[model samples]
Target: MKTYRSLALIIILSLSVNALFAQNKPSHTDSLMKAGIALTDAGKFAEAVAIYDEVLKASPDSKPVLYEKAITLNIMGKHDDAIIILEKLLTSISTPNVYAALGDAYDMKGDFDKATSYYTKGISLWPKDRNLWLNLSVSYSRQKKYPQAQAAAAEAIKADPRHARSYQNYAVAAYLQGKNAEALLGLSNYLMFGSNNQSLGACNVIKSILYAKPNTNADPVAKLEQETIAGAVTVATAGKTGLAPIDSLVLQLTASYKAIQSQENQFGSSFFARYFGDFFGAIATTNYMDTYTRFIAVSLSPQDNIAWLKAHNDDVKAFNIWLNTQKRQTE
Candidate 1:
């Protein structure tokens, strides 16, 4: 519930809230909308919807209000109510936000096919909409269609390379398909955007993959990948004593990226070699690894690294500038 509710709120707030205020200006609808948002934030979802109903009674054709009301209904586990409002909105004037909300409502109702249909329709209308692609990928993943999920996630990433959620979805989809290298690369790119509560868990998964032993009976590519990761861990930790955990992680990541770069030509233009290998390989050659390490660590342990980020604002800025100018391989 938290997952879908949170995503629905993002779409609602991003597409509707500010626009509602901007268009309404100093109207009473503005005040009511704020109150409704406040109520929704305070977990008084019923009160919030009632406030939206009040606004709609006065300004009966308020699309933003309608969309937000539907989202709040979703958060309150009223998917049928949300679906009713969203479907009506779609009939009058279709928009990406309405499509996304409708898909989310159906998804929460355990109707993946309906959710996928709405998402696909939204993407067809707005091909550059990363959120639509992301949701479609999630729907496919829920149906255990890993390849389709990965392809949709790749489309999301190509649509908006800077969006963290795109990479996060891509990483999960790739990992589910047993493409660990691609998964690691996707996670690395995702971390570059920022960190959140998900950061620590992602970091732990990364370390586990880096340290896992090679499977003797695996295919050549998988076997080589395992060996590369295992060897990177040894190279990172060898002759090192009392290294801080974050420092150890930085060493291991750099070692792994460098090792992948070394084998880029061996794998020719395979997805991992062409995309993951070339991208992180470029970073391995730069002096930004320390800055990158601390940047991500800020989310891993805020108490320990937040001040470091604050104190080193220039470093963070420089690293971000370098990262943003770099292009990712989307093919």
Candidate 2:
């Protein structure tokens, strides 16, 4: 599942949790499951476990109950318990989704080998389940096994050409494998079909490619603007684009300009909210906001856009360096 989908499901589970449990004087198995789901959503895993136990006590081998309990246990960081339940469930209920969930649990436990094992099992059981390959790729990435991760994610793309996570996973793996062109292609695909900001991957690549050159002195503003324009054109073609990062940079730029011009530290987070909120996926912490503001103070100093970019070029360089060293997601 996409991270956002998991978040959305948690929201839906929270809303129906109490209402589902309150009906008919206490609960049915469905009601109890809803209660467990709700508790899990609320981060009340222990309470959810009690509800899950109530169902299991009545029907010791209830697959649904077992699965729910396993998920809740994993949520509580109790991976071994969850894995045990998942293993038991496998005997009576063997399916792709189940195995995916099991693989996720194992991954969380830092057992990538076992995680990929279950993911492969899931794939064998349901070859068309594109998600299985994606999950397997993620496991491989976590282990720093870039080549294997790339192969699995590529399989996911072949299985379902439009699968966004497949591209994202593949891009990360390719980058780790030092296949810059492959990474760029996958990142472009992600921008078009997955996350709107391909810059999360692309800017770093540009910076790396630029930085790796000998005796190079690329104009910072021109380089950034050029890369930004190219990335924007690539991403803004359809419903697949997002405008948060630049929108965020603009707000920061303005705030720093105000502070520098007025010499009066007057702007508040409210200004950031007005612009940054429009682009960022979530509200940033005060510390992160401060860092951006500080960046602006340094970057916008000369009032010459070129000077500003040159002064703060290090931030871009740093982010690029970080991305370069990031291990593949599945390994």
Candidate 3:
């Protein structure tokens, strides 16, 4: 359950590279930067760095070149060198992207403390930057600070509700903290965006949680998890013998959503209670639970679910239509 796979570094680095190229107009240096990026993509880090250096020789202090070079160095495992370039960039330009790159460098070097520091600094400068919050969440999760990780992920979600990785980070933290219900809710939300290795692992964990006996712990969170699991189990077993795995899953999830709805008053102002509750609660009330079930199940085995999805293409389209009409709560 402690499995925390973060695509933040690579994803953010790619975004930064693309953003830099997008903002600057065409020029000789721009062409070089694109070439360097192409080289980096081809795993020719040395060649990419050489190209960046060639650009720097002509336009010294080129922010884009410096940033791209640092990124290349990071890919080459030259974290210290990356840090030096990023630090110099910070002295001249103060941007969340620079701070993010520096954090990535420190994180790659296995210095979670330094990485956390830079991510926190970036958040202070640009409080709404979802990438900083998301990366901070990753650093905290790596340090096994589950509560802080969850909180940081909440911020990331608040900043950008559509960012899939934030939900994945939140799910990992919540699941490791024994908050199974919250983890499932986060996983459902993450699957809405796309599937990946981490999301697939989470889907397996969701199955395990649904199948496990109810938690009898006295902790309030455990109690809620117990309630949710009980609801799922009861729905799955009641007069429904030999149900297919996907059918059982749909029933369990529908029941779990109902369980969450039952505790809406108890959930108070927590983000999961307020946001995830409303979103999934709506889906639970719809005829679309089967579609949603198959939708998420696709993450587990895309090939296996392909025929079913193809057969239910119209249902999928209707679900998407209904989904587009649903408004997500960010606050």
Candidate 4:
């Protein structure tokens, strides 16, 4: 009886130890996952993969770990490897993120057809996902299917009205389809909410076109153009010193010319000719006329004019400062 009791006590103690370890196993796995995610965030992709491997050895079928490893692989440009993992994950679980990731992988591989199919599948499963719609729009745009791209972009916009990417996609599709008016509107909307150099360049091009035409219809495009110019003038005049109104006008025009010159690549000589008349002709004609009129009205000697400009140099400096501020803000 004493030997049997001793054996039973040992068995109970062994079982309790095993139960405790079993309860702590998941905690250990969680720690491994957190460490892996940190490494991934720090861009140590290979190290993150190794940690994930350790976690997988414990939890062999962890969907979250598998998905995270696949994303890290994708970031490492191992699109094929990422796709393989994601495809296997689909066999066990069907999630929108997995499908979207597969679409991204195929898109990176230049397999737009496969990307589109995956994106469509994801969209069908999660119709309200703006990102999937945006991805679909991009894929369609890549195929030069502007109409379909526009439709997808519109859907993305409907899903999240504040998302700037949808507007960008819409602008591209509209521009490709020769819908200049709609393209300009979309670009303007993008500029209002987002800051991208490419979008800024496109906005400058569209603004140059509108400036050349000067639509009398009071359309949104015309209003945007007017507002842009007005904003520039406002910034330029913000540093007004003891200069006369005519002097201020001259300073504003000078600031405007500098602004246009800064983006000369976007608005070329043709744009200048169409909007402000020929560059050389404007210098010879309009500029000469303005100078003569100012000289006669002010009746100041060249030295006096120089002195006046030197005194108001702060205004010019202010305009330049304002322009730089705007560029930094937009970029």
Q: Relative to the unseen true structure, what is the C-alpha lDDT of residue 64 in candidate 2, on a scale of 0 to 100?
A: 65
Best by TM-score: 3
Model 1 misplaced stretches (Cα beyond 4 Å):
1-5, 17-26, 215-224, 235-244, 262-275, 299-321, 329-331
Global lDDT of each candidate: 0.77, 0.56, 0.80, 0.59
RMSD of each: 3.6, 16.0, 2.7, 19.4
- TM-score for candidate 3, please give it: 0.90
Order of models, best lDDT first? 3, 1, 4, 2
Candidate number that wins on TM-score, 1 or 4: 1
Per-residue lDDT for 1-331 in model 2, tens only? Answer: 3353344224323434234223232345777777777788777879999998988888886666677777677767788998899888788767666687788888878887788889888898888777678778877887888878887887787677666767777777866655443454455445434223343445445335322322124344223323433343333333534644444443433332222223111212232223222222121322233333333233223244345446667764664464355333211
In the range 25-81, model 1's lDDT, one tens digit per residue, is: 336787898888788877788999999999999888887788889889988889999
* TM-score winner, 1 or 2: 1
Q: Provide the TM-score for each candidate, comma-separated.
A: 0.83, 0.54, 0.90, 0.54
Off by over 4 Å in 3: 1-6, 16-26, 197-199, 215-218, 265-269, 301-304
Candidate 4 lDDT score at position 28: 64
